[model samples]
Target: MIRLYTKNAVLLAVVAAASYELAAEFGPWPALLTCAAAAAAASAAGAFLLRTSGVGRVTWRNRLAGYLIPWGWRLNRGKLWPIPVVSWAVWTAVCGAAVLLRPAPDQPALGTRAALLAAWVIDAAALVYLLGTLARATPGGRVGPIWKLVAVIAGVISASVGLYVGGQTTAALVVGGGPPVVVGGGFGLLLLFVVTVGRNTRWN
Candidate 1:
């Protein structure tokens, strides 16, 4: 279900990016927004699947527990604990930067490129951490190194490009032919990463 939906989401994103501003076609706005929504929903569904696929009910239930056991300190779960925090912090910083760079008073509240940039930064940080963590944990005995390499390469290049384009573009969303391409490419890379990680990992 999630797989088919995710594919559909990506397909929508691609089609939207390609047909924007045309006379009789759907615009990029719908495509990117749909992709963003789908990406978030798909990620959530995948995470739930991961927790329930035999990691022990205790582990799964504890995840929702309100107790702040302190992941990087008090809990002592894994060496990878700091990665989540770092990822979140990076995202927060980018968001803060965006707030600082907000557009003029007259622009649409949400049309402020800064906010969008912030969101992009947050998403990029997450993608980097999630896929990067999996790639790191991937052992040499089972999954080939190429999968991890693909994760790292695809994650970094696409994310950096997307963020850069988002940050660099001027007020006009369609002024430069870059933002849509960057995001579309980034999502494509992310889709690839998800597929590869799912295929090559035991945490399935």
Candidate 2:
């Protein structure tokens, strides 16, 4: 649909802007390389997540088929609620924390900080639209054992990395690297698991 394409386009634009801002901290060549790597990583990750989550696979398949045949692609809005909700929530929290807690001397310009905040707002809007689409697609669904296992494994790895990083940078942990890692890797994964898997539900 036009709306789906519009929302996706907006999200992509924001992501590109953010990527440029982040990568531009380095020189021109490094920025170009970073952007290229980020694009590739994002595409691969998106495909993997879509396949693993069992959502949006049909859309991609249809698009691929359209490329080979004469018929236009039928875009079925998939159950993409969790993807934007989880990813944007984690990204906003982690990035916001990093920006706020960055050392005073190394803080980004006010304009850059403002732009980042604006991007988060746009992401929030996109998330709302995706959730609405998902709700219309399906009333509800249960998380399966495989996803729960995946969540647990991801959570454990995140917590372990957070602890290790926190230990290594004890002095700057509170001010610099610590908060983002804790908020992102520690609390983010916990929140994600709880929301997706539920608190009282049995893992098995």
Candidate 3:
């Protein structure tokens, strides 16, 4: 049960974070808040699952989690931080959504796309922070520079998403406005490359 809870926490956190980012990019405040709420709920569920279960009857993840850690590290192995962290993420995501829902004045005015872009950037950053917290909380959290490097790269992705979103909204006056969807999508794809190939680089 503990193992399951751990795995569930890790899984829910990462997915929720990613979902928040994607939803922000697409727009619609209700959807973003819902995604954030689900993530927070999942984290709590994981905690509950942990509290009730014994180690012997726990999951395979518990067994493997230690192995994933470095030679001298240990996972926190509880519901406290994970649940609260997730809750905060959801809270922030909801705030971003609220800000987004305020109704943009117009494209040319100091509203509309600006609010939308701000929401996306904040949402993306929140998710990245959530993911980083989860990564650092894991059994391997204390070990390698790999996690730090990966975290840095994830930060870059957030920045890229923000820049892309801003560029998308302001493209009309910027000489050439490539579609934001295309640019954002491309940036996301590039992240996949780094996560796949660079996550294990010498620096990490």
Candidate 4:
């Protein structure tokens, strides 16, 4: 459990940093669009990975116990809908919001900044949620070196590009320069390191 949490946390940091870097590089609007594309591709790729990794046989009834319990009282577990479907829907909505709400390249309006911030916060939360589901979906789900390579490449490139664009364009209005790159890049590297350290995890 500790290992899984650590891994997902690092993954979140990587995605956040990458999003900031990409934002800075491309500006918020473009970055978000790029992220929308990358995320879409990544989601497809992730599904494939889960199948290849032999962990994709997940249904809401079987999968919910692994992730949804963490939310505690906020979610009425008994009444909640299928998590896999809901999770994907949430990802889509968040991406849509990113596409729609990301501010322009120049100094944006206060409302734009506020809306962008809200979008990012929701994105981060969704990312963490999905990561948890991914982590718990497998049993002795040690992936191959090739998959690790994919994770590293995908994580870094997507994140750096995503964060760079996000930071420069949308988040810049709120968080400013230099810090975004530093934080994003730093966390990205940390994420890579964490992925390497736990290349193989088995709860048994």
Candidate 5:
């Protein structure tokens, strides 16, 4: 289960990186569309691969749940700073990429792509690591698989949008002069974060 979660996290991280890269090339809206299409394609390919790999026919719902970091809120309530830390780390990486990958005056080149991708991978790993850590620390009060899957799917989308907004905003502010309309996605991302933490935190 841990391995599965890690793999999915890695994949999502790749998705985030790729989406941001696309955003750098195209604009945010078009980059988002391309990401959606890519996600659909990747999901289809994943389904087919799982079906044929003798790994047992895992439903898409379960697969998505597997990708999410399970929140053992009750078990780890006292040590919850890590979640925010993970999120902060992601933002920090974005900041670094913005400055480090800032395009030149002539035209955007390929030199910064590798650095951005590396930063994205670190961001993804931080998220997955936090989830894995919490799951390992706590073994109780888990949400239902269906709910978990739903929460994670929404969270991933929100995260991706947030990343796009951050990446684009940084590029615009520091490097290029892109749009600053990240409020829609930023608000959604914050809301989802609250939802995930609040819903998973066991009060009993």
Candidate 6:
């Protein structure tokens, strides 16, 4: 669909911009290389999991298709919207805290900070829009209440710890603490997505 592509384009643009800004701290080449390696590693891990899960070939193909071709996946719009919106908000909050708490001399100019905040807001909005659209195309289903509650609690705890660490020691927050929270949030989202979409999926 034109609308889906447009939304994805917007989301990707925002992500690219955010990544570019983040990469400024490290050189672009190193950042690009790191991202490439991470992507490859993730792909390999995903492939290994799929291969070892004892699923039929068709089921494995469907799962791989869902991941590789997200637009084709049947997603419940109502359930999908909130996930990205909330995830992006939490990520932004954590990164925002780091920006705010940076040493005075290392702090970005006011204009830069404002621009970053604006970009983050746009990124979140775009992600919600895109995922929400996908959700609308697919039939809806109920995710277990337990999973929802767990996600909420995990998000809150991660945000609290990230904020506290950022305030106490920005170095530790950036170098050690921040990554785990982000990674945890990512895995949580992935699990939530699997639970929500996988349940209603009909494998060939």
TM-score of each: 0.32, 0.26, 0.35, 0.34, 0.33, 0.27
- Candidate 5 lDDT score relative to the true structure: 0.46
- Name the lDDT of candidate 3: 0.47
Please provide, for model 2 over 18-54, each residue's C-alpha lDDT reduced to its tens digit, 9 standing for 90 to 100: 6545544644445555555554454445545555543
Q: After superposition, how far is residue 135 of candidate 3 from its true place, in Å?
A: 9.4
Candidate 5 local lDDT, 21-89, one digit each (tens): 666787665766655554445444434443344344566644553233222222334564433333333
Instruction: Give the alpha carbon lDDT tens digit for every residue of 74-150 in model 1.
Output: 12234434433443333233323333333434444544453344344434434544444454563554545545654
Candidate 4: tens digits of C-alpha lDDT, residues 7-87: 545544455456556666677667666665665554444444433443446655333333322231122243333343443
Q: Candidate 4 — what's its lDDT? A: 0.47
The TM-score, computed over Cα atoms with residue i paired to residue i, of candidate 6 is: 0.27
Supply the TM-score for candidate 2: 0.26
3 or 6, which is superior by lDDT? 3
Better of 2 and 6 by lDDT: 6
Candidate 1 Cα misplacement greater than 4 A, ranges: 1-55, 58-61, 65-80, 103-109, 112-115, 122-204
Better by TM-score, candidate 2 or 1: 1
lDDT of every predicted structure (CA atoms)? 0.42, 0.44, 0.47, 0.47, 0.46, 0.46
lDDT of 6 by residue, 1-204 (tens): 897667644544454455455556765555555544443443444445444565556566545533422331233333433332343343344344333433354554545444433433333333444444444643554535534544554554445445434543333233333434576689999899879997787866
lDDT of prediction 2: 0.44
Cα displacement (Å) at residue 105, model 2: 26
What is the Å distance of residue 181 in model 4 from its true position? 27
- In each prediction, how many residue pairs overlap at the backbone (N, C-alpha, C within less than 3 A)? 0, 0, 2, 31, 0, 2
Q: What is the C-alpha RMSD of each candidate to the true structure, in Å?
A: 13.9, 15.2, 11.4, 15.1, 15.2, 15.7
